[model samples]
Every structure is written in C-alpha cells, then in structure tokens.
Target: MLIKHLIGAAVALALGANTVMAAGFASLGEGLTPLGGEKSGNQAGTIPAWNGGITQPPAGYQGSGKPHVDPFAADKPLFTITKANLDQYRAHLTPGQIALFDTYPATYQMPVYVTRRSGSAPQWVYDNTRKNALSAKLADGGNGFTEAYGGIPFPMPKTGVEAVWNHIARYRGEYVVRRASEVAVQRNGSFSPITSQQEAMFKFYDPKGAYADLNNVLFYYLSFIKSPARLAGSAVLVHETLDQVQEPRQAWAYNAGQRRVRRAPSLAYDTPIPAADGLRTADDTDMFNGSPDRYEWKLVGKREIYIPYNNYRVSSPDVTYKQLLQAGHLNPAYTRHELHRVWVVEGTLKSSARHVYSRRTLYLDEDSWQAAVVDQYDGRGELWRVSLAYLKNYYELPTTWSALDVFHDLQARRYHVQNLVNEEGGTIDFSQAPPEDSEFKPAALRRRGLR
Candidate 1:
C-alpha cells in the first residue's frame, strides 16, 4: 500500500499536470478511509481504525433540535495534561496549547480521552467524495475549485491550499437554521452575550444542485441579532463566493439605528467580526474561511496531536454557560481531548497582501476535513491567537462539525466564543427547509429589520 502511494505520486509528478490529485487511492474505501483518511490505524494502535463511524443516533437521542446524547458517556479520561507535567506530553502538543498552560497554569488542563474516530457523513457524501478525488482541481489559483460539489473537494489533499479547501467545502448539511450566542469574554472574565438566529443554505452541497447551478456562489447566509435591546434588530446577509479573487464575497449589514441595509465592503480579510470586540476576524469565523490567495500555502505533512474531539459535554444543556466560560479558556472539566493524526498546513502572508495575521497554521483532522485547531501570528513573529473547534458528530446529519468555536488571544488575556446554543431550545436544526433565494438578499435584510 505504501509503495502504491509512492508510485502514484511519482506518476503525478511525471505527468506534470496542474491539477493537484490525491497521492494515493484514486477512489474512496480503498487504501483510504471512506472520507480519505488512512484506512489503517497507527503502529501503536492507540488511535483505532475508522469503523463506519456513528451512522445512527445512539440510545436516548431525541432528535435534531434537542440535546444530543454522548455515546461515550461511560468513558472516563485516560490521563490529564497540566502545567505540572507539561514536559511529559510536549511531543503531542501544539505551541499555542503549551502557551495556554503558561498563560494560566492553575486553571488550564487537558483531560485526554480514548481516541474514538467517530467522524462520518451521509452515504451520498462519501460517494461524492470518491468522485471528487478523481476530477476536482484547484481554480483561480487556490481561491476556488472546479468539478466538485456536495462533498469534500480535496479529500486526499496534495497541497496545503488543497487541505484548506477541503475544510472550506466540507459538507455541513444542505441547509441549517441555528440560534446561538456570541460572547467576547473580557480580561476580568465578564461577558455580555450577543444572541442571534442564523440561517444558511449550502448551495454547493444541495443534493439536486450542480456545479453550473452554483453560479460561483458557495452559500447564502443571513444572521439576525435577537438579544440585548441595543444590539437587537440588526442583521447581516452574505453571499459567499467560491472564486474570491475574481469575485469577492458579497456582504451587507442592516443597522437597527439607521434602518437601512448597506453594502459591507470591509467584511473580509482582517476586518474585525462584529460583537467579537477585535478578538476575531471575519475570515476567522469558521476556524478559517474566504480566500487563500493572500497567503502562500505549504503542506507541512501530518502529525499526531491531542485536540478537542467528541466534545458533547461542553455543549450539553446540562452545563450552563457560566460553568463553561472561564478567565483564560473554557473550563477544562467539561472539555475532552483525544490524540489523532492531523494535516499541518502553514500559510505565510504574501508580500503584496495586507492582513493582520502574518502567518497562520491550521491543524486539519484526517478523518473529517474540519480544521480542528488554528494558530495565528502577528507581524512581529509572535503568536497572537489560538482557535479550537469542539468537534462532535451530529449523528442525525452524520457529519462532524464544531459545537463551539473558541478563539483565545494570548496577549489581551481575553477570548471569543461562537455558536453557544447550550441554553437555546432548538439547538441546531439541520433539517431546515431550504429557504428561498430572496430571503438572503439585501432587500430581505431591510424588510426583516423593519419587522
């Protein structure tokens, strides 16, 4: 199997093709797992092989809207990593994670759990991923992809940008409606939640849709603020474009005070996300999003690291936000970490590009294409922020996605949290009926704001 992969890589290089093809296994479920991870486990046998993942909901799973039951509820932590024994586990930790211990020695700790490779998607997604591995190619210089829809565009990624594209185009669901809250925790651990209702249609992943139907649009999203009188009534609409270099992302903002929807040109790149208080950027919303043209990406290969995984406890309704949110980071008691293989991709900002982050490193899970951890650096070659995705498989949708995305600022002694639906009734509804195209337009933003 190893020789087959080497021969395939050699053939690709000899052909001198511009299309970045997978180094091994032309199709899925061969030398690769269904979603393109290594089919076999490591030599140590700590991380188990992908055994068809969580295809069905476990016992006591009510539905999509209710809290999901943790399948590993009976499992306990194998060991814990703390400042006291940081050196012992230094080989399996990221620099940003090690910095966390240094920043808050007393409260920071990681409860390592047994690795359960519970990442799976719908059967159709697996089918599409196999087809994509043979045909999909990068377009617009890594800013967009072609001949790919409904699944990961680069499952057996060959380049750094290809790995990032897999994360960008990975299937979440056809459509989803989620009501969640955002909070920018202050240095003193005080926070005022900015709750909002969000709806999105992944046009690229629509079962009935085709590449031509996309019309260069990736997804349509509309977010309406629903809390704290002063911040309520405001809304934002976005048309995420695939080829961002040729056609940048289109965004609009509806201000309650002005009662008008205006084009938001400064909503991309290093633009600060609203309500995040400069703790996160617009592109930093989903670990990383938008264009990859600003930076030169390099595939740094794979490494085994301890990352947050199967984190159902942190987002459980039984655990309130007060208990979860702490000073330097989220409370470690509710979090779960496991060792898994991750593709390390580094993006260095181009000389011509002007952005806040000079360098960015993404840790992409091998099983799912999700970017589980990200380390962002500033111009002075200093680590500025670290982002973590608490990934859990939504058994109903059968997709692995983040329950909560946390960004910690090492310098400011603050952090920003997104997608906090622990207290919300409906949680995340992946079965949402596909919304009309008009509902995501700028005109709709004004109409909804007026109502």
Candidate 2:
C-alpha cells in the first residue's frame, strides 16, 4: 500500500481541490467540527451549521426499534425545482439531477427544502475520530489505510482518493440488522421484489476492537434472500476489507437449489449484482461501494447540490408500493430534497480496469460522508445511469445512512431501489453488539443454508 505524509496547502493546490481544516488532531472540535462538517453556518441562513443530530428520536418516536416519526413533518419545501425552473438552480444541481428532468420533464421534480446538517454519532465516535486524525494515513495506491480505527479516517482529506476514503470509512453504526427489499421497476411501473434479511457489523466501529485487531477487515455482511420462489434461500456472505489491495474481499455464496456453498470472487467491481435485475452494478450498491483500485479519483472541490436529506416522509409507514413507485421515478410528493454542501469527486476508469462505468462523478455529503448522488457513464462517454440515496437519521445511533437507494438507468427507463420498507414496521436493529467472527465463515454459510 502506498501512503504519503504530505499534509498542507501545496498538496491541495497540486490536487486542484480546496483544503479544509488544518492538519493534526488539535484542529478538530476547535476550528474543525466533529465529523468534519463546517462549524459556521452559510451566509444566507439557508444551510444551518452542524448541531448535535437527532440523538433522541422525535417526540412521538417509540424508541430504537420502532418506525421513526418525521421530525420535519410540518416543515414545507422552500421551492420546487422542475425542468421549467431548473436553469435557475442548474449550478447547484448535479448532472444526474438535471438529467432526470430531461428524461421525465413533467413527472420528475425535486422538492427542495432548507438544508439541515443533522449528522451525528456517539461521543465515543467523536473522540475516536479526533484520535484517528493524528494517525490515519493512506494505504497503497489509496485503496486502503492504516493507523485508523473507528471514526472518520482522514478528516482534512487532501487528495481525491483521500476524500473517497473518508466516504468509504464513514461510520454508519457499530452493528445493524435490516429487513428490506430491493425492487427493479420497469417502464410501466410494474416491479418485482427481492426481499432479504441483511446484517452488517462495522468492525471499524467496534469499541472493543483496537486498531491492531481489525485485521484489514472493515465490515462483515450477510444477506439472506427471503422471497420469490426462484430466488428464495439464496444467501451471500462478504468479509469487506479495510485494505482490499493487500487482500481481496472474501465472498461466499450459498445456492438454495444446488445446496452448495462456494467462494464467489466476482462480488466486487462492475459485476451485475447477484440479487439486482440488471439495472445496477456491485460498486453502485451503496451509491458507490468497493475498491478504488480501478479508477483514478480526483477532488473537484465542494459544491451546493439539491440532495435527498432528512427524508422521514419517504420512510413513513403510511406509504405503500402502489403509492410510492411510479413509471419514471418515485412519487415526487412523497420525496424531499434539500440544498446542502457536498464534496464533489470524479473517478475516471483506469485503462487496465475492466468495468462498465467509464467514468463516475460522486457527490459525498459534507457532514455524513455518504453519497447523495452519483453520475455513471458508459464506455462511449455517454451518461448511462444516475444513482440517488435518500438519507435519514437512524436516530438512536444518531447516524445518517440510506433509507432508500435508487439506481436509475436513463437508457432503459428502469430503476432499482433497495431498502423500500415504508409500509413495514421497524426494519433496522442497532444492537450495539458486534457479530461473532464465526458467523461470517464459509462453514457458517453452509450451516445457515437451507438443505
């Protein structure tokens, strides 16, 4: 792994990106706010500065396991951005956002509201991030890092890859289990659901595990498909690594029909996702996930973009599949967008890397390090797909993650959205207890597979 120790204005100038907080641990929580969000509010008062996020769920919320109530249910959109008025907001909108209008001018619209910087983590997380600032350095070719555990790895990121790393290493929670569905919708708004029970244990956030104990693994994931006769009982296991360059991700798949568990090295990169119909790629799963080994990422400076944020209405239990899903996009009235600051990073596929996306433009939320929108290009340099993530606070953990992640294929007029359980109750569990290492092994995959 290639890691450099250059932290200064020179690196920023060379990389063609704006440098944020000063180098070192002392700057955090002082001049630099926790989680790397700007401490001061924007001049226009449209975007407020970071305050402690929703530590306690909204007043009516039934605690950690219940459906989260919309804290901003009474709040209204400041204005709506459509194709007619898009030009005025063009500078602030990502190319993906603008393309949606061109594709569905009449139906696709963004209900933009005031930006709320509500990203927060536990106090221990903040403390760990401050310590990580002093030690975390890039790994070989910038695909991995060392000397950092828990917290944001590089708060004052200098390179484009560093910014990407920050997004990859961002905290979701210590451990979480979710029951959700991934649906692929066709042009006529007809859809088929792929429901699954998934568990993720972020070893990076394991308070008991120290830096040395991480063993290059960031998280362990298991997805067990629960429905559809043809796909039922299919399961996937992944041991996502901290340094994928040194050791590739360890993946295993259990075939319900075959009754066999086998190693699946093809889980990463641009491979069509196993459960997804053909609309999305493996790396496109988390808006943008997996290895950075195939692309040359560049920091393009920060910009204000109208992105999905604090979207409780989208996650409200009142919505149903019939009401939420539409031909070209989700029901606009049920979605919410906010004008917020985001770090723009572009990835150009390497000549040697064999992948579908020739180029990708990623917009990472400044406060949460989550991808708000990603523009994907085909080999011919034509815009092919756009990915959007509706972010909401998992209030008890006080972390922001995708409530629903949608990947729209512009050419096909189709899209795939994961985690659409609005009509269902209590889909996420933050047990604060990490999974045992035994559960992620191949033997366990076989044991858990239905015979």
Ten residues in sequence with the least summed lDDT for candidate 1? 1-10
Q: Candidate 1, which segments miss by more than 4 Å at Cα? A: 1-23
**Model 2 stretches with alpha carbons more than 4 Å out:** 1-24
Candidate that scores best on lDDT: 1
- Writing each residue's lDDT as its tens digit, candidate 2 over 111-202 gives 98877777777888888877776667777868888888888877767678878888888888877877777678889999877677778888
- Residue 397 error, candidate 1, Å: 0.6
lDDT of each: 0.84, 0.79
Q: Candidate 2 — which pairs collide?
A: 1-140, 2-140
Q: How much lDDT does candidate 2 score? A: 0.79
